[model samples]
Target: MKQQSGFTLIKVMLMSTMASVVVIGALKETVIQERLTGNFQKDMNARLLAEKGIFTAANNLQKIVSDNSSFSVDDLVNQHGLHVGNGEIGDDTVYKARLSKSAEGLLEITSLGQRYYGDANQQLVARFELKPADIKSPFQHAVTGCKGVNLSGSGVVDSYDSSKGPYSETNRDSSGHVNTVIGDSSVTITGNSPIKGDVKASGVIYLKGSSPIIGDVHSNTGVEISGGGGTSYRVEGNVYSGGFFTHRGGEVKGYVRAVGNVEMKWGSKIINANNDPYDIMYGGTGNFPASYHAQESVQLDDGTTRQNVSYSDAYFRKTPEIEPVKVYDPSSPDYDPAKPNKECDPFELPLNMPDVMEQNPERDQDFAVGATQTYMFTPKIGRLMTSQVGIKKAVALDSKKAEIYLFDNLSQSHGISDTTEERVFGMKNFKVYSDGKMTITGGDVIFLVDGDFVLDGNAKLTIKSGSSLTVFTTGKVILGASGQVITEKEGMTSSGIPSLNFFSSYSGRDGFQVKGASDMYATIYAPLTQVKLSGSGQLYGTVRGSIIDSSGGSGVHFDSALKDVNFGSGGGSDEKSQLIFKGWFFEPAKPLPDLETDEGETSNSDSGSTDD
Candidate 1:
């Protein structure tokens, strides 16, 4: 029996010790792996902190850029460093960021996030770039409508650079090929019309009669061309249609591309503007350029580019041809409501309105009126100051002095001396609200109407040279049949027009109506209302609204200078400015687990070998 126990006690003890070593090593490795995972998670949190820092820096940079017109992106790279605190976490977590100019005028922002006394083990990094948003004009096109645009009768839609000499439609630019008319629904060009610029339609385009277009045509739906008998429909630019294209008569000087079939009628001509027939494409789809909707390149009088013309042709051409534009949806990340497109986005109201002093003691004097000699508010009496009130006896507003009128809500309640200078009365900047009909003949004035603006009895709001009239209305803007919002200044450019801004944010059925034989020279912005142009004369300025309606002969002449005009005093201290977002990326730090503290502490210690 003693011989049977061949295995000694020492051997048994050694085997037990080896097994204990293996188990201890396995537990240690498991703790190390778990510690590594915890460290990795901590690194991710640090990276998020870095990303937050980048966001803070970007917003601050935008504010700085918006405030300082003279500062360039390069200046930020050289002079700016931002330190941001993480409020979500403890105070130990902080981020430092630096901004610099990257390639292609982009702003590069680099942020370093650290925690626990900024230790190297608890740090992360992130980087992103910013691009300035482009500044666009709502008046870049001759006509931009959300419903449909119909050019009937002998109506002519043309383009002329107001930056040139006197404004004339005949002032053509050979290289300036901007879109003349844009309709979200359909476009009908009939009668003997001529469009000197391109045309775009989200639905369909009907080209009948003898209308000739000097530029291209694009349609997301289809294009139907019919010259009829003895009529010639000619198009000088390339034509693109997303759907079927049918040409019955007339000639296309440029190439034609369509996503559907291209049908040609008898005796139809396909002439080439560049001697290339291959430019004609059919049964294929293509994208529209980004600037296809609002790009204006004009030849100025001195042959110098406007300061707002900072964008290159390629910048706008970068849009995909397959899908150049999309129906604006607020929920879409691609859509930016702040970007102003006459065909798409609605206009945003400015914060500050024009300042017109109602009571300036230095210039307040009572003028003689009909032997009654009642007190008439006058900031500075002009040359044609008179007491007669009718349109025939309307005072000419073209005087050298700044004429002022007070339409105070408290004009009767409080005496002039007893009235506190509230906005309802008058401040140094804003004039009091007009409760009743206000009349003006001629003078530089700021008219503020809190209620309906009515030009009764064929009244003429004549604006002449050296005269600047700014009209702010909260209600309907009604112009009578004979009422004329005319600007009569020789050699006057787009600046001759009055600055008319409708600050109505309400969705009510408020509208702007210009009727009769009168002509209007004003930049009309009524994004929440409809704009209707009737009567005989033309409207020579930009018109933006929820819907635009014009009589067949009510010609609309878009002023090119509106691209840079400051409708509100809020911006445009420097003409060319836009806030863009460019390269955005988040980089996370790699996990480097520390063996010291990340592991779980264990108090139980047991030797595998029992004591002898």
Candidate 2:
């Protein structure tokens, strides 16, 4: 038995070694497979969570905007999901925000999001960047929040606290071109290399060399280029023309939406311009194309700053309309706290909500719409269409989830569940609707529309500081016609009429939609801008960046106008509150030809005329 069992020691050792190698290989393969599967699942979950967070943030922002007609990151955070929580769509997983601006006025946002794994115990993280679609945004050069030198040129970025007075240049970089960026603190761009981002704030943005931009440029303000550059070059953002913006002798080859008082600079070889100085957009074109927007009365200050004087107004046009009398009770104190806010503008369409909130017998059973059609409420009014035309019904949703459109705040329990349903939302909460006869019936809807809005005879409209809006005809605001708009907000310095700095954003869909009775009366009690009228639509209100191009049609009818308003120093006169003409203050005619410079100009030789 001993002899049979006894294998040599060397043979036994060799067999053991072979077995160990096989076990290690098999174990490694299994671990690798598990890891791969885990990674894939983690990525999928992260993407879903990120999308959810974005939707949630957008919804909350809408709510803020609808109320004041404006919103910001702070407002969003206050309204939406928490930055940290258990849900997959927590703030850490998703966030809508604004990053710090460079000296050029570009905003950049950066963040990391965590994803949920199949098991409650597993999660992963992903880094991301959100770039805004405007010129001069810091995101292009990786200049975020308050870090780095975001100015145009390259060198040590000079730091100058505006609060501390005049800025001084300390460190000098004599190496090359001195197109340095003025930053928040100590930063620099070696003019040798094209700074990573767009040239911010100052309308004058330029590149010393022929290098094109790597990221989009944002001129939410405007842009000015020296050295003869024009429309043949690449610009990722909108190009605002304040003055004669010639590049370094090149052409612009991208999108440029100019909205200012007048053409800043004259045309050059870079862009084909007609002799008419104001005809900047149609520089070389002989005729003014209907599609071209000739900003006649616009003022392009410095390159980044501008204003469309002709149109400026703000308003909420809160649904459950109002013809503001005196803001008293809850939504502006009123005789009947339960009655709809009389101060709300009528023309401002109400956001669609659950009919349950209104006990009207004629309203739709519920505010639900299929993907095929816009939410139609047949409450005496005809079919209404909102920009948010394509929204799916909650009940009809395939996954039992209500397809919230233009809404925010999905996690904090604001959905229309089968049982615990309450108020639903519209686009980012910015717009809501119910296609029914808009007869004021219910506890007044008191959402705020930020800006200075003008209400015609739907006089219940109330505008406050910096906000501007124009009420058109058609709908009637809730408040009775007081003929006076309440012009005040909670945190305004002096009780002045609407201005620009008040809101982070604004709204004015259609500006005004006046019908037979819905006309803009006047706001003697409050300050106002110029009101223009001519055709079908009335001036309900206006946003900061808007142009009233009613020139092709009839002039907008304005029964009244504002008075003695100072827009700025050495600029243009503010006719009453109308910085620009009430109507379309633009040059619509085609530019005359430049035949004189070309060989096309010649005398007839057959009849003894000079043909030289």
Candidate 3:
């Protein structure tokens, strides 16, 4: 019995040892499975963090571009890396993003994510391309006046497509429209001047000339036509007026509609293109005489009679809806009182001069050249400042593209021969001058001036064939009689009108002036100034200003090609093109390196400390 009990104890001891071994093995397997699952979770978390970093960087870049902020790619490269963290991640996962330029010159962002308590990490890279944004241009009309427009002399208002050829009788079209935002007698056409296109005004339109208008006429107020010595000033298209229609001695070749009375005198007639009298719609009572030959006849002041004149009071019972013109008013919600020039039209001027000037770094040296010396400018020279500069010989640009900036106050005295002296009441007299010439031979060049830009005397600024010149100024612009802003290029048939452009921000009374015999083959845009063209010189491009006053046989030919041009937002608008997203990929895991913080301190990624 003792031997059997001893055997049972031995067996029980062996069984218990076996059970302990099995339990220990099972526990070890469970721990190993848990560790593998935990590691897998950490890897996924790191990958998600890396993806978040990419999105964050992309969003920030998009914002910068959309705001039109002045930023350089080098700035992002200098930042080394941008760190990101989340409150819900419990300080275990983080990401570091870096921006750089790829071999193809595209923008690339690389993100690396890590977990603090584990050895898990992930990397991702994305690419993008930069492009110019599309924005609406404000130069939609031949003449856009914030105040008014005055056309006199024998010069005509017409248009031609510069892309096809120069301004000729055959190439001309009736797209030369004139518009004004003012609400008085804002548009006047007198003398022998004729408008080949439409004329639209917010107020009264007065036409007194021998030449006829070949297009439609629209006014929110009244339409008055007075022929010069009964030479027959006619309108070949339809006429719509909100107020009275007065015709002294002229013919309307189309229908006439008015909200008020229609006054006809001295054999004024209304007929359609078929030589048949069209029915007139008038809201007020007017003289109507019956005749045997036709519907009606009216005897005028000159003892002449107009026959076949038909009138109907029921046609225009309600006033026609005319779209209101947007003008610069202080009470308007779009008006910004903080602007320096309050009279400048907000809708017309889209460039932000201050921001544009600040985008480029100022050159270390000043630009001062003697009258007899010639200066060769290249693209490497960048921007230079000068209180005043004189170029009696020539300031030539190299074959490579270049952009030169000249900043000056122009409140001091300068030694430029062709200058204009203006005397202020309480201030010292200042002379504004720009003499000599800047010739662009075989390159595209741009000159940005921060002060008054004047070209007087025999100054001749020439743009050669296959080259272009663009100028932007914030002060007065005067093109003297002998001065020439030419794009003809000796042998070519004038570099298309878009080759030369002048944009000004001057806001004074006579901010821009083009005198006699100046060969100006450039487009002038001075929306904040009073533009005075007093010469026989023909302008071959377009002109947009606050008020346009043309006299003395100065003719303006509009270039229809300007409608397709896209001028940038000048780095101050919230307009941008959509960012194109290139493909992204996961890179091999790598150890994180130390990065420089914005505060000029070194930060370690492995230390697990987040950037503030």
The model with the greatest TM-score is 3
Comparison by lDDT, 1 against 2, better one: 1
Model 2 Cα displacement at 156 (Å)? 63
Model 2 Cα lDDT, one tens digit per residue, 396-480: 1111223221122112122223433112211111222232111111111112222222323322333333233222111112221
Per-prediction TM-score to the true structure, in the order listed:
0.53, 0.22, 0.61
Error of 3 at 263 (Å): 8.6
How many backbone clashes does every candidate have? Answer: 18, 152, 0
Reference-based lDDT, residue 357, model 2? 20
Judge candidate 2 against the unseen true structure and give its global Cα lDDT, from 0 to 1: 0.26
lDDT of 1: 0.50
Candidate 1: 10-residue stretch with minimal lDDT: 603-612
- TM-score-based ranking, best first? 3, 1, 2
Please give the CA lDDT of all the candidate structures.
0.50, 0.26, 0.61
Candidate that scores best on lDDT: 3
